[model samples]
Target: MTDAFVAALPKAELHVHLEGTLEPEMLFALAARNHVELPWPDVEQARAAYTFTGLEHFLPLLFRAASVLRTRQDFYDLARSYLTRAAADGVRRAEMFLGVQTFLDAGTPIGDQLDAVLAAISDARTDLGIDGALIVTSQRHRTQAAALEVLELIEPWRDRLLGIGLGAAERGNPPAKFADYYATARARGYRTTIHAGEDGPPEYVREALDICRADRIDHGVAASADPDLMARLGDEAVPLTVCPLSNVALRVVPSMAAHPLPAMMAAGLLVTVNSDDPPYLGGYVNDNYQAVHTDLGLDRPALADLARNSFRASFDDPHRIAAHLAAVDAHVRANQPPERAYRAASAAR
Candidate 1:
């Protein structure tokens, strides 16, 4: 019953990476189509190689799979496939992050990437009935100058992009380094989100908020370590786009049972569950919802709240957000089993 409620609940996915969505099956197909040689000869072998010691270990492998995406159609197919899956998972709105700098560095034209993705988004909205937007993510491993260059290059498509984001290795690369880039993005009217605290320290989360002024913090699990930071996040009602399966896959947390999502919510922060890299991490949004429910012992109400939080944290328009929130409420109210409804009525009495 809980599973059915979650699968049909209206929700928004706010932290997925487009390049990271490249599945092994699609990876091999694109490799053959583009005449690129993959490190793994077969899909089974590629799937077997997904183990990672940490974020650093996983990035190189992600980049290798991304190499197969060389054409505009490659990106179109990638976005379309992921959007289809997201719709099935009950994602009403999706804000996907694409690391534009990597493709630029690889010599793929910016127009080819953006045009294909935007086209996919437009078609998906029409065909799948899932509204979608893109966040042109700049790789943190690169210099701030490079990030600025990317910001400028994307200016032509600014109206199409939902926002700008900082992603990739966050260890030595602090959020402070991209302050100017973020400031510039904001000056140009782009919503800014930063990846922090997944692998970096609590200080990184602080910098993201105090320095970058991030509209949302992605993977802010580390903020739990600092009482003041957690309190500030709560007081500010800052949104943390938390990814349970991705955290475990990257070893940010030992397992789903040990995830800090429950505590994050308990602290009053606006926390939303997402599948950061669905294919690479072994789950999508609904999978993350079920994992937290089973492993963390979150009840149906808690799961519903998480779904509501997702819609609230999204960058979609206000009317749409309200409508989606209403939909979530309706689904929860309609799906309650008799026993649970009786309990709620009894508690109210």
Candidate 2:
């Protein structure tokens, strides 16, 4: 698709973090509002500090950004801002990840955070026409009991929450570490996904599938390294919410051009692109799509397929998913070149 068409196509985002969407300007503003002091004196300095050697290196700053968000209005504002931007980018639906551990650690009640965030999402949907849901993500570094506690807190809002997710540092704490929590979530009838194979190895992806019973794999880039895993993923048609910019920013991959997305697609894996941590990674969904298209040379059809997979991979209701997919299909068809015109153009070339 042309740039304009790509930009206009209705899309869904399955792997974005609400806290990570905290832009530097908003961070400072919220910090000041809460009477909290930030480590960076200015926006540029805060932007500079976003550079990270790894996920662990980034967590401190990530937590610091969360520190400023102390009240219900703060969470509401954060969700509203993200939803507004997402709607502007043609996002018809979004399943946003919100890490609760940091807020809980800071002494904020989990119920208050959930209520405020959900309230903001509800308001944004009404005002902005953006359909979205929340995913309460548990930190991998924390114990399974901690994750279970989060699930308990989320139980009341289960209808609104898409599901529970495993996030944060993924290196040593494999999916197996949270097997019981995930199983409990599944037994409770919650949809599940986990972060694996971005910083961790392919084995982690396997564990996420087998042990944690993940329905989707987030950042399953390293699955390309293992032929068995790749085949299994393809056979299962498991969706991978690949975040190209997040990989580059976290140094999981050397650069955007070298991202494994193209390779994963070529291997017949179900791959979808996303902006995992948009603000920290330097862009949002459209920026990520453009980067992958330019750097990886993804063709228009492939790009449309990625867009389709985004909705398919999402946890939105079936009726809503159908509507979004129909929109994407309509956009693709309307924007497609005529067959005869394409033939003539090819002959002329």
Candidate 3:
């Protein structure tokens, strides 16, 4: 499919991190605004440092950039910028993960951070017509008690939050570590998602399901390693927010062509394409869609399926989800060639 077609397709972004959306220019701007000194002297140098060998290599830089976000206004600008970009890329609904615990530990009040981010979401809904909500993600490397503390901390704004997520280095911090945390979040009526299988094993994905009872799995490409896991994901229709560019950028896979997304689709899994951390990872949602279409041989119809899957996998209301899915169908019908359109319509059946 053409890049234009992919960009025009209606979709939802379910796995973006607000901190990770910090563009180099904005990083420099925010750093300057907050009177913070960055190690990189220029934007080009900052961009150059985006290279990474793995998630461990990438996270330090991610958190370091976050250091510039010292005020409520800083968080507002970051969230607004990301929502604007997501809207431009035709994202109808976005569930963004904010590293609340990071800032909470930094001594920024939870109310200050949520106030700024929720304000951005409100403005995005009004200005861009792009609806979204925040997911307060806890760092996995930290202790489970710390995660539970975060859970308790977010109780005040539980109504504004879409869910809870576990992020960061996943190797040693298994999903089971957050089981009690997720249990408490669920008990309090918050949906749960866990970052599994990106830097961790397939067993971590299992724990994310069995132990944490995660409503969704982020970077769950590791599920492809176990045939049983693949079957279970397909049968259960557990949504996986797979970030193709992030996988390649972080060396989770050798390259985009080597990503297991195609295999996951073959196994009938409910997989949605996302930009985990676009600025650091190389591309946004549209870029991920374009990469798959070019490198993985996903045709126009297949790309549309990815878009539809995005809405289907979202935590948005059922009525909104149906409308977005219908919008995707209409977009495909209008954009694709007549023969391709007919084939796509048939394929949906």
- Which has the better lDDT: candidate 1, or candidate 2? 1
**What lDDT is reached at residue 76 by model 2?**
88
RMSD after Cα superposition, model 2 = 3.0
lDDT of 1 by residue, 248-297 (tens): 99999998888999999998899999999888896888999989988999
Q: Please provide TM-scores, in order, for all candidate models, with all chains considered together.
A: 0.97, 0.95, 0.97
TM-score sort, best first: 1, 3, 2
Lowest-lDDT window of 10 residues in candidate 2? 1-10
- Candidate 3 lDDT score at position 1: 41
Candidate 1 residue pairs that clash: none
Tell me how far the alpha carbon of residue 201 in candidate 2 is from the true structure, in angstroms, after superposition.
0.7
Superposed on all Cα atoms, the candidates' RMSDs to the truth, in angstroms, are 1.8, 3.0, 2.2
TM-score of 3: 0.97
Residues 1-349, model 3: lDDT tens digits: 4388988889999999999999999999989998889999999999999999999999989988898988899899999999999999999999999998778767788888999999999999999999989999999899999989888888889888999999999999999877889999999999889999989999999999999899999989998999999999999999999999999999999988789999999899999999999999979999999999999999888999999889899898999999999999889779978897789779999
Clashing pairs in 2: 1-300
How many steric overlaps does candidate 2 have? 1
